[model samples]
Target: MIFPCILSGGIGSRLWPLSRKDRPKQFLPLFGGESLFQKTAKRVNHSGFSAPIVIGSNDHRFLIGEQLSELGITANSILLEPMGRNTAPPALMAALIAEESDPDALVLLLPSDHLIRKEEVFLEAVRGAEQAARDGAIVTFGIKPSEPNTGYGYIKVVPGEEPVRRVDTFVEKPDLARAESFLKDGGYFWNAGIFLYSAKTMIEAFKTHQPALYEGLLAVMETRHSDLDFTRLDADLFGKLENISIDYAVMEKAENVACAPVAPEWDDLGSWSAIWTVLDKDEDGNSSLGDSRFLGSRNCLAYADQGLVSVIGLEDVMVIATSDSVLVAHKDKAQDVKHVVDQLKSEGRDEVDRHPRAYKPWGY
Candidate 1:
């Protein structure tokens, strides 16, 4: 059986005004009152998958629990991090715990906030990567790029006919020209940040590549205690561990790494432009939600929550109107929404952190 380890700790700052610190984008109902986290949980709940193990922030523990409960699902375990330390340490901790029950446990580490259409294809990819993962390979699902997207990292896979190919190299986010070149070059895949590996295989990789992190997280996991239904890690000890992503700590340097090319209509939804790209656009190239209407507008996205929103004589514009705030940006500058968040953070504005309809243990 494969265990899905969902990492739900990121505070998505790019989709601000809608995505907030307290109630991040993952927890919000982005699609028909179903959150991305809920969608992710449902996606991995197929026959070959086991009950999920969630690794999330201390602040959003109740949100995770309540959301899962709402869907009539019970998690295998909920591990609470005292603070954010990126992916490396928490992944290591999950592997260590899984190894306790079964040494050969296959752990599928995925972000709680990605949009992957075509569930059958995604499952097929997971099944195909199982063999490589069992053979001691840390397999990462690499999305076949549909365009020259500069927001995502790139994975250079070696030329091969196999479903799982050796990773040639991992590159940072490329500029426009470089991204276009990679698309034309045809050997690169978008680093989707989804990984599959056995407990023993990942443990061995950590022991070799990151010995200090391996040992520190091992010790910290030993001291992990259960609070109600959630597992709580030692805050002080976890804080002492190095803060790094799995790509930088293991996948980039490890010899036993492979890339599984998957093109199942995947998107990280990191920005409003990405959201616009995935949504169903009309003939005029406009996407909308809530009470929204567009007139003489092309390539525009309008989201209205509390009232009617109309866009007229606009092109390549995004308008997100919420109960408390509104964000209007050009489609090309969708990624720059974080700058507004930064400015608000500098002024210590609560709007930068959370929404007015805050989620809590009981109710909003």
Candidate 2:
């Protein structure tokens, strides 16, 4: 059976007003009615997948359970991290847990913050991954590069079968020149951070590629506490882990790595600018998330909640207002607006990391 493994602990700092530390992007309903986590769950559900196992922060256990209950969806488990140790450990931990019950179960590892508009294409890619995964391959969904995105890493695929191929290399975020050249060339796809593999294969890859993480995960599994839909891992041991990603820990070093193409209109929704791309534009080519009044404005995104955002003749600008902050940046520059929050924190600003209303398992 296809069991989904949702990694919900990614704290996106770029989408500041909407995505705060206490109420991060995954939990925020910035997309529409459903939060990104809920939307990811729905994707797995609509694909006729089995009940999922979610891995998130202990602080978000209540919020997660409440959300699942609200949607009338039940998860197999909800594993908690004491602190954010990045993707490698949590992914390995989830794989171990899944192996305990079903050694051969294919676990589709998904990050909670991505937006895939073409669900059918995504499912087809998953189906393709299923074939490669059964052949002892750790498969990743690689989105065809539409433009030169410096924000995302690149995955070079070695030619193989019709649907899936061997991953030749995993490249870091390139410079402007290299990114442009990558787009000019073919065979390179954006690393989507989505994976599919058997519970058994992932655990073994961890043991070989990341022995330290493998041992750490073993300790967590040994003493993990399961209550309702939550599993609180040993906080101290989990905290000691070296902050690393699955790419560095295994995928880069592993031989049986495969890349499956996804033809979906997908976005990680990592920043406000990315969000603007998916939203409906106004008559002036502007996208407004919340209530706002605009006059003589053209090609601007206004997400106003705190006060009246009146834009006059602004071209390609992004304006976001929250209870404690207002961010107005050029549309292209919104990607770098996160540095503003970083500077705020350096001056002892708490609003950078938190919002007025926080979400919990008991409800928002």
Candidate 3:
């Protein structure tokens, strides 16, 4: 069986105002009233996959439960992390939990905040990589690059006729010139961070490549306790584990790493501009979420949480207005929104943390 493990521990500060510490972008109802998390859960809700295992922040336990309850989909286990420890630990933790039931069970590790337009294509790619995964290869789904996007990391794969190809190397985010060069080279793909591997395969990878972290996670799991519907790991033990990504901890070191190149119209939606691209735009290239209008505006996005928002004679500009905060920036400069978030964080502003109307289990 394929056990889908959803990783939902990111702050998503790049999409601030709409996305905050209390409620990140994944939980926000951005896509026609459904959150990215909900979409991710629904994507794997197939007969071929088992009940999902969610690993998210402890602070978002209630939010997670409420969202899952809304969908009427029960998770196999909801593991709560006291604090962020990146992807390496959760990947291994999910493997460990799945290994308890069946050592050879395949685990599909996914990020909750990704936007995949073509779900069927993505699933078909997963199915294609299943055999490679069962054959002891840690198969990562590499999105075929439509553009030379410098926002995401790149994976270099040996081109072949097989469904899964041997990964040559992983490359960090590159500059525009390097990104263009990668596009020119047909062997490069965007590293989407989606992995398919057997539970035992991942556990052994961790044991071999990251023995210290492996031992530490074992200790943390030993003292895990259940809280309501969530499984809580030992805070102290978890906090002490190394803050590293699975790419660094295992994939880069392992010789069995493979890539399944696919084009599913995938985007991480890391910034407001990215959000604008996926949204439905008008003839004038203007997109609005709530009560908003545009006058002679082209390639602009406006999101109004409560009141009316209007943009006049603007080009490539975005306006995000919430009850408490308003942000206006050029579409090209959307990636710099994180710097604004950083400034707010430095001032200890409440806007950086959450909106005025907070979401709770019982009531908002």
List per-prediction Cα lDDT, in the order shown: 0.90, 0.83, 0.92
Clashes of 2: 3
| Each model's backbone clash number | 0, 3, 0
Q: Which stretches of candidate 1 lie over 4 Å from their true place?
A: 359-364
The 10-residue segment with the lowest total lDDT in model 3: 355-364
What is the number of residue pairs that collide in model 3? 0
lDDT of 3 by residue, 198-250 (tens): 99899999999999999999999998888889999888999999999999999
Instruction: Score candidate 2 by lDDT.
Output: 0.83
Per-residue CA lDDT of model 2 for 207-315, tens digit only, reads 8888888887787678887776677777777777889988888889999898997769999899888888889988888888878766788878888765677777778
> Which is the winner by TM-score between candidate 1 and candidate 3?
3
Off by over 4 Å in 3: 360-364
Error of model 3, residue 201, in angstroms? 1.1
Whose TM-score is greatest here? Answer: 3
> Tens digit of lDDT per residue, candidate 1, span 150-230?
999999999877889999999899999999999998999999999999999888889999999999988888888999989
TM values, all candidates: 0.97, 0.94, 0.98
RMSD of each: 1.5, 1.9, 1.3
